[model samples]
Structures are given as structure tokens and as C-alpha cells.
Target chain A: MRATTIHGPFDMRVEDVPDPVVQEATDAVVRVLRACICGSDLWAYRGESARQPGQRIGHEFLGVVEETGSDVSGFRPGDLVVAPFVWSDGSCEYCREGLHTSCPRGGFWGSVGSDGGQGEAVRVPFADGTLVRLPADAVSDDRLLTALLALSDVMGTGHHAALGAGVAPGTTVAVVGDGAVGLCGVLAARRLGAERIIALGRHRARTDIARAFGATDVVAERGEAAEAAVRELTGGQGAHAVIEAVGTEQSMRTAVAITRDGGAIGYVGVPHGSGTGLDLSTMFDRNIALHGGVAPVRAYIPELLTDVLDGTIDPSPVFDLTVGLDSVPYGYEAMDGRTALKVLVKP
Target chain B: MRATTIHGPFDMRVEDVPDPVVQEATDAVVRVLRACICGSDLWAYRGESARQPGQRIGHEFLGVVEETGSDVSGFRPGDLVVAPFVWSDGSCEYCREGLHTSCPRGGFWGSVGSDGGQGEAVRVPFADGTLVRLPADAVSDDRLLTALLALSDVMGTGHHAALGAGVAPGTTVAVVGDGAVGLCGVLAARRLGAERIIALGRHRARTDIARAFGATDVVAERGEAAEAAVRELTGGQGAHAVIEAVGTEQSMRTAVAITRDGGAIGYVGVPHGSGTGLDLSTMFDRNIALHGGVAPVRAYIPELLTDVLDGTIDPSPVFDLTVGLDSVPYGYEAMDGRTALKVLVKP
Candidate 1:
């Protein structure tokens, strides 16, 4: 089998790698049907992350189960599934409390303890707790190709931001970026009953997608202009909720500044640590509630999968470009160069 | 009338100033029965604040209504009242939303547009909003003093912390800081139905007060030890709610650390600008919610006043020392030297 290996900054190549088989009783082996590059993957591509050399990189995917260990009961061969970026045991104390991101016994792929999904076949630990089975029989190519693949990572992440920010019915929400995750935030806010969804996007194509995802308004401004535009749309009262999908200082500040005095702000972007200078006083004075962390993607995947199945949300549209496992390097480059919003790779 | 004036950082003076009278249609003149030094006042006293020179310097007091403008109807001459430190007009959108501290036309005493309360007589603006009328008949002793004087600010602030933190019955609560506000937090937590109250206090006297105010456990450690102590008391789950009463980095971190995942951390102290560097990743990862500010003190005074009148909670023990209005400078020195947790000056 061939795997996408990270050699150095902006240097990736597909190399022949040993195939994976289930090692744990609760594990399963999946044949990758689709996998893709995430925005966070660019962090490593740019040498901005602590990822070591030669590691397989992808975490978002739709795969078909090829084999399962004896202890794996709920899933079997030939079933299509979506697994969250992080694997969890689903029974730990943290998992019980829905903090699956901090699951004690669970290990994240591509970072520590296990090989990631950026290859032809990958071992999935905690299969029962982590994998969401797709609806039987009607897994259409278009449905499988939907932006729902992003739900395995980015879309789930955007939902985390929306939930953490307390987006609810009648709330006005401002999303800070137009990336896939941010576009998903616009969708998540719509699903969560947001009345007014504003997407701050500079990209025309992505902004149009955001509108389709339920953004009632779109602002092409950044930083102060973006904040001012949001405030103006909100009648100078500021948004009731803000989802900060960009990890830059300007995005974070816009998230805070565009929120009302007692509103909520949630950030899910993997921050670059560039904007370390947060005005703690201003946030403090506003009495706003701040809550977010890396998304417990596994915890949200089931609901998102259901939405994908019912055709309530078409997350598959984000896969505007597709390539083969041999072209994973090109996929990364295209996304890094903004030539593609997302790239789906067929193994 | 005599007043406590902020000359500069580390410089304060007791001087004769012109007696105040109703200056606005919504203002009232109060003959201060007692004025006190507050922990927040120390910010200006130490010259760390941007307060200008020669300004009246206090925000907590019990006083008698001396006169009122033609439009001030709810308050009249001879009424004993507890004044909200943050004066509001009770009509602004923010005020209507129960955010009197952020009211556009409102003012916080001795900090920005309003005069301080540390004097014989202070002008209490927005009388209908700032002054909470006390019961007509009162026994003029320690209990009445505790209920009236302390409830004027610190007690209300403590309630704000518990409320902002969303404390409810049977919730485990951790309070950081040993000042009057922290002690009041303990009391407020009890009033809000907390089943377990762990107070982190370094001072024996303050800890004793915390215990008296219904803290179930007291930890004498400042930083890590205090957090450990609270975690131990909580059976390693950490507190469901955390009330932060100290503005230093250590206190903020300790407060953030001891709060359980998916918990609320509310802070009420005047923040120092050293930048404690909030772990946004940690905040996001834990799903912890942070809500705080200067305390919408004005918004809460009415309910607290009713509690004080009904003998539900006594907060007067915080007034550990008292002196005449002429001794305002000494009161500041006493609080600065740690000789008095709070100082009340009578007109």
C-alpha cells in the first residue's frame, strides 16, 4: 500500500508502506474510499506544527470496513462509515461527560500512538466508540462526495464552535473565516436555529457556499472592518454569538468585538499563536461567555451523519476537487495554494 | 465635606472638598453614614490605575438620602440606602438587559465619570438606579451595619460572582481569594444553594469569615496547593463552579485550573494588566465557560437589598474597622498595610 508521508515543510510524497491490520480486540481495518486534507494539515505542511517526519497525515475520511477484530460487534465487513479525527473508547469518564477529546485511554491518529488515515488502509482503534455507520443501501456517490467528509473533522469542528458559542434560536451569529470549517459553522448555526448568520469571507466561491449553508449576510472585511460590519448588521448591539474559525489574532479579536455585552464566543481554529495579545480587560468588561476547545469530533459525528443521510445538509459539496492516493501530495499543494477548498482522494 | 483623594500612585490625601448636591435630574445627594476602602480601591491607591489626581476615591458606602433632584422619585430625604458602586440610569438598553455596569450613560464611582463614595457626603447619580432603599426601621448595631454597609458593594459583587458562574443547589463551588469579596462569594454561594464551598484563603481571619459564611472547606494555599486541596475535597472531579475574586495571574490560573470541564469560571476583581496569558487551547479543550466583569452591581442590588431587609444573609462582618470621615487617609493606609480588610468611615 502507498501512504502520504510528510518529509519536510511543503514536502510530501506517496511512498510504498506496509499495510495495516487490526492489532486490538476492539479495532477494525478499513479500506479508504475517500480521505482529504484538513486546514490543520497545512500547519504541518508549513512546518508550523510539531509533526515528525514520515508520518501519514490525513484524519478525515469515509471508509469501508474490510475486517474487524473478534471484540468488534456493532460493525462488520462492507459497511460504510465516517470516523471522527480522534478515536475514543466511548466509555471512559471523560467520554461519559462528552469530553471525548480528553478520553484517557483513547489515542489520536497522526499525532501519537497510532498511524493515521492518509493511506490505502489504516487500523482504527476504538472502532465501536469512534465510527459512525452510514445509512444502509443508498450511499450515493454524490452523498459520499458531499462536504460531509469534512464532518469527520472540520464540519464537526464548526459545530463545536457553534455549540460552544451557545448559538440557539433567534441568535445572531458571526463566523470569522470562510474556510471549510467556517463554512460548516454557518451550516451548523443554521441547523442550530440561528436567525441571522454572517460569514466574513473574502473568497467569492466559499462565501457563496456559506450563503447556501445559511449565512444571511456576508462581510468581505477583515479585522476592524469585519467587526464594524457585524456590529452595524446587529444594530450596534453586536452578535449574540460568534464562531471564530480562523486562528489568527485578528479573527479572535473580531469574534470578541462583534459579540454583544453578554454574548458568547467560541473558537475552534488551531491557533498559530501569532495573536498572543488578547485584550483580557475588554472581554472581562463585556461580561461575554467564552467557551471552546478542540472539537470532540467523535461526539458530534453521529448527529452530523444522520443529517447527511437525511439530506438535511449537503456537506459533500466541499469536495470540489478529487485525486487518487498517488496524488495526495498534489492534493496538499492545491489546498495550500488555495486552488481547492478541499481535495478528496480515492484509494 | 472631607474626602479621600487620589493624588497619584502611592499618594493619597484627606482634604476638605465642597459638599455635593444634586447635579442632574436623576441624581441625589447622600449624607454618608459610612464609607469604606475596597480591594478594588487599592488599584487606584497603588497608582496602577489610570485614575487622575485629586479625585474622590471610594465606591462602597451606606448613606442617608439628603436631597434629590425634581425627577428623583423613588428616593427622598432621610431614607437610608445602600448605593450601587456603578451608577446607572436604569433605562439604557444594557441596563434593561441587566448589564448596568456596561450602561452607556451610567458611571462607576471614582473610576471614570462619577465621584467616589469615600467621603462625608457623595453625590449619588441616577438615584433611582444606584440607591437601594433600606427598611425604614432598623436596629443600629453590628447586624444592621453588616447587612447595609457590606451588602452595598462587596456582598453584591460576591453574589455577582456566584450568579455569573451559574451556581445552583448542590453544585460544588470553589472561591479564589480571601478578601471581603471572596468571603462574600462564600456567603453568596451558600445563598445560591451550593452544597460544597471550598474557599482558598491565606488569611486566618478571612478564612474564618469564609467558614462563617458557609464555606464547607478552606484551603490556605495560594496557587497549586489550593487547587489540589479543592480537587481533593471534590473527590478529584474539581468544582462545578469557580468564583474568582482576585485579579492577579496566579489567582486567575488557580480559578481556571480548579473548575471542572464544562464548568463556569466567574471573576470579579479589578484586573491587573500583566496579562496572565489564558490558555485558549486549554479553555477550548475543557469546554469551560468563563463569564465575569466588574459585576453588574447595580442590577443585583434590589434583590440583595430585599435579602438584607428580610434577614436572609448578613454581610456586615466585612467592616472590620471604622473611623471618621477625616480619617479616610488612615483607612486607606490600614487596608494597604493589611491591618484592616475593610474600613468604614462615618460622617
Candidate 2:
């Protein structure tokens, strides 16, 4: 088997690696069917994350079960399934409370957890809690390309933003960022009954996709000007809810600044330290509700899984490009170079 | 009439000033029964609030309705009342939504609104929504000194903390301040069914007041040590709700860091942006809810009017001293010197 590895600044390699085997009784081995480079992956590619080199990279995948340990249940060899980026025990109190990301035994799929998901095959612990079954038969390459892959992280994240920000009927929502995840947020806001959806984007392609995903308007302005555009669209009151998809300082500030007084702002950007210099004084005066952090992707994947299966949501368009696993490194480079919104790697 | 006025840094004057009159059609005249110097008043006294010379300096007052403008209703010339620092119309959409502070016609008592409350007679606008009627008869001087005057701001702000933080039964609440507002927060938390209250304060008097109000423990520690103390008391999980009464960056950080994952932090402090940088990144990873700004004192005063009338939540002890309106300048200096928790001035 081959695995994608990040070995320092601007360096990515697809090299032959040992095939993963079930390491725990609750583990299952899965042969990767599809995986993708994430918007967040670009952070480490840019050497912005605390992530170290020589680590297995990638955390989103749809796969076929190859084998299962004794304690693993609900999954068997040859089963088609998707897994969330974070794995949880599923039975813990926190998991029961639908906060799987905060589950005591939960950890990430790549650098911060047991192992990475970039390889052709990998061991998935807590299989019952982590894997979601597909339609019994294998999905088509195109249908499964984006939706199943998105189920692993981005779609759930977008839903997390909409739900956390309390977007409801007639709500005016502003989505910050034009990435695949942000586009999905536009879709989520529309599905969640947002009366107005504005996507702030600098790229025409991304803005078109955002409009396709339900963005009612797109602002080409940047920084304070972009925020002013949002405010202007909102009648100088700001959006009722803002989905902060970008974690940079300016984006976070824009997210806060473009929300109306007593409005809610949900942010899922994996932010750096500089974004912390927010002014609570301004937040206090506005009576705004800031409710968000990292999206609890695992907790929301099940319902989103149903939505995808039932045809209520099609988040698959986030993957604008799909390629064989051999091109995984180029996919990372393309993402880093902003040539692709997101890349799906069929391992 | 005599009043307290700021001449310069540490320079306060007890001098005669023109008595207030209804300058607007919606205004009413209140003959001050008692006015108190607030912790925030000391900011101007210490020159931290950028005070201009000879500005009337107070905001907390309880008074009698001596006169009403032609448009004013709901009270007669003899009705005793407690005036919310902010005067709202109670008719606007924002007021209807319970955000009276942001109401279009609302007015703050001192720095940003119609008039200051430290004088012998204060003219209040939006008369119908700004004043909560007292009991039919006159109340005691001590009760007026503590409960009603303190309720004008600090006590109500403490209540804002508990309400914004969503404190409830079985909750472990951490209050980040030992000021009168923090002490009142302990009382508010207990009233809201918080099972454990932790007060972070080094002052002996404040620590005692906090315990008297319902705090189970007091942690004199600051910053990380204070967070550690809160975690130690909550089985290493931190408090379910954190109330930040001090608006400095340190208290904001303490409140954010001391809350459990998924907890709510209500900060009512008039924030000085220098503390903890209002770091939203750390807040993101924790999934904390930051809800607070200026207290909607007008919103709460009606219900609290009943509480004060019935002697249910005694806030009178917050006033450590009382002086006539002529001694208000002394009150400001005493409070600025930390020799007074709160100073009440009788007209």
C-alpha cells in the first residue's frame, strides 16, 4: 500500500507504506475508496499548523471494509462506508450528548489521533462508532466522489455552522470564505431556511459555485469594505447569523463585525493565535452570541448521512476535481496553489 | 442644588449646579432620594475614563417622581421609583426583543445619555419605560441605600451575568471578580440554582460578601492559577457557567479559560481591551458561548422591583457608606481610593 506523507515545507510524497491492520479489538481495516485534501490541510502545507513532518496526512475518506477485529460490529468485510475525521467511542456520555468531538476517547484521523487516512488502506478503531454504511451496493464513482467524501468532514462542518449560529426561517446569513466548506455553508444556510444568503468571495469561479449553492449575493469587497457591503445588504444592521469559514484574523473580525446586535456568529476556521485579539468590548455592546469552535463533525455526520441518502442535500459539488491516489501530492500542491477548491483522491 | 463634578484627575468638586428640569416632552423630573458612586465612576475619578473637567459624575440613583412631562404616563408626581440608567421606549422592535439597551430611543444615565444621576434632581426621558415603581409606601433608608441604588446598575449587571451565562440547577458557576457586582452575581447564581459558586477575589471583604451571597469557595488566585482552582473544584472539568464581572482582559480570559467545554460565559464588565486579547481561537476549541454586553437593566427592574419590594434578594449590603448629595465628591474619592465598596448620596 502507498501513503501520502508531508515531510516539511511545501513537500508532499506518496510512498509505499505498510498496509494497516486492525490494532484494537474494536478496530476494522478499510481499503480506501476515496479520500481528499482539505482546506485545513493547506495550513500544514503552508507550515502554519503545529503538525510535524513525516506524519501520515489526510483525514477524509470513503472506504471498503477489508477486515474487522473480534469486538467490531455493524460492519463486515466488503461493506461500503464513510467515516468522520474524528473517531469517537460513541458510547461515552459526551458522545451520547451529541458532542462526539469532545468524547474522552475521541481523537483526530491524522496528526493528532491514532493514525492518518491518506493511505490506500488503514485501521479504523471504534468501527461501530466511526463508520457509516452506504446503500448496500457500492456508490457510483461520481455520486460517491463528493458527497461521501464530504460526509467525512466539510458538509458536517457547514451544517455545524448553520446549526450553531441558530440560522432559522427568514434569517439573513452571511458566509465568510469561498472555499468548498464555505460553499457548503451557503447550501446549509439555504437548507436551514435562511431568507438571505450572502457569500463574500474574491474569485469568480468560487462565487458562481457559492451562488449555485444558494448564495443570494456575492460581495467582491475585502476587509472592512466587504463587511460594509454585508452591512449595507443587511440595511446597516449586519446579518442575523454569520458563518465564519475562514480562520484568519481578518475573517474572524469580519465575522464578528458583520453580525447584527444580538445576532449569532458561528466560526469553524482552524485559527491561529493572532485571531485571538478580538475585542470583547465590542461584542458585549452588541449583545451578540458567539457560539462556535471546531465543528463536531462526528456528532453531525449521521443525520447528514441520512440527508445525503435521501437526496435532500447534495454537498458533493465541493469536490471540483477527482484523481487517482497516485496524484495525491499534486492535489495537495494544487490546493496550496489555490488552483482547485478541493480535490478528491480515489485511492 | 449641590452635586459631585470632576475637575481633573483626582480632582472632584462638591459645588452648586443648576437643578434638572424636563428638557424633552417625554421627560420627567425625579427628586433624587439617594444616588451612589459606582466602581465605574472611579474610572473617571482616576482619569482612566477620559473624563472632561466639571462633568456631573454618577449613574446609580433611586428617586421620587416629582414631575412628569405632558407625554409621560404610568406614574404620578408622587410615585416613588427606581430609574434604570438606560431609558427605553419599550415599544421599538429592539425593546420588544428584550434588548432595551440598544433601543433607538434609549438613554444612558451618565456618560452617553441624557443626564447624570448624581445631582439633587435628574431629568429622565422615556419616562414610561425607564422607571420601575416602588412599593406604595416609602421604604427604609438602608434598603433604598443598598438594594434600589445598587440595583440601578451593579446588581442588575450581576443578574445579567447569570442570565447570559444560562446558569441553572446543578451548575458549577465561576465568578471572575470580587467587586459588588461579583458579589451580587453569587447571589444571582444561587437564585438561578447554581449548586456551586466559586469567587475569584483577593479582597477579604469581597470574599466574605461572596460567601454570604452563596459562593461555596473563594479563590484568590488570578489567571491560570484561578482557572486551575476552578478546575480543581469541578473534577477538572471547569465550571458549567462563568460570570465575568471585571471587564479587564484578565477577567475575560479567566472567565473563558475557567469554563467547561460547551459552557457559557456571561461577561458584564465594562471591558478594557488590554486583557487576554479577547482570544477567540482558544474560545473556538472549547466551544464556549460568550453572551453579554451592557445589562438590560430596564428589562429586569420590573421583576426585581417585586423582589426588592418583598425583601427576597437583599442587595442593600453592597453600599458600604452613605453621604448626602453635597458629599458626592468625597464619595467618588473614597470609592477611587478603594475605601468604599459603594457610596450612596442622599438628596
Q: Model 2, range B134-160, lDDT digits (tens) per residue?
A: 764655555644577777888888999
Cα lDDT of model 1 by residue, A144-249, tens digit: 5555577788888989999988899999999988888898899999999999999998889999899899999999987788888888999998988989887877
Instruction: Output the TM-score of candidate 2.
Output: 0.95
Candidate 2 residue spans exceeding 4 A from truth: A273-277, B138-141, B274-277
> What is the two-chain DockQ of model 2?
0.61
The window of 10 residues in a row where model 2 chain B has the poorest summed lDDT is B136-145
What is residue A254's positional error in candidate 2, in angstroms? 1.5
Model 1, residue B344: C-alpha shift (Å): 2.5
DockQ of each: 0.56, 0.61
User: Per-residue lDDT for B238-326 in model 1, tens only?
Assistant: 89899988887777788778988778887887678423735666666676777777788777877877787777888888778878877
For candidate 2, give the lDDT of residue A120: 91
True contacts kept of 2: 0.67
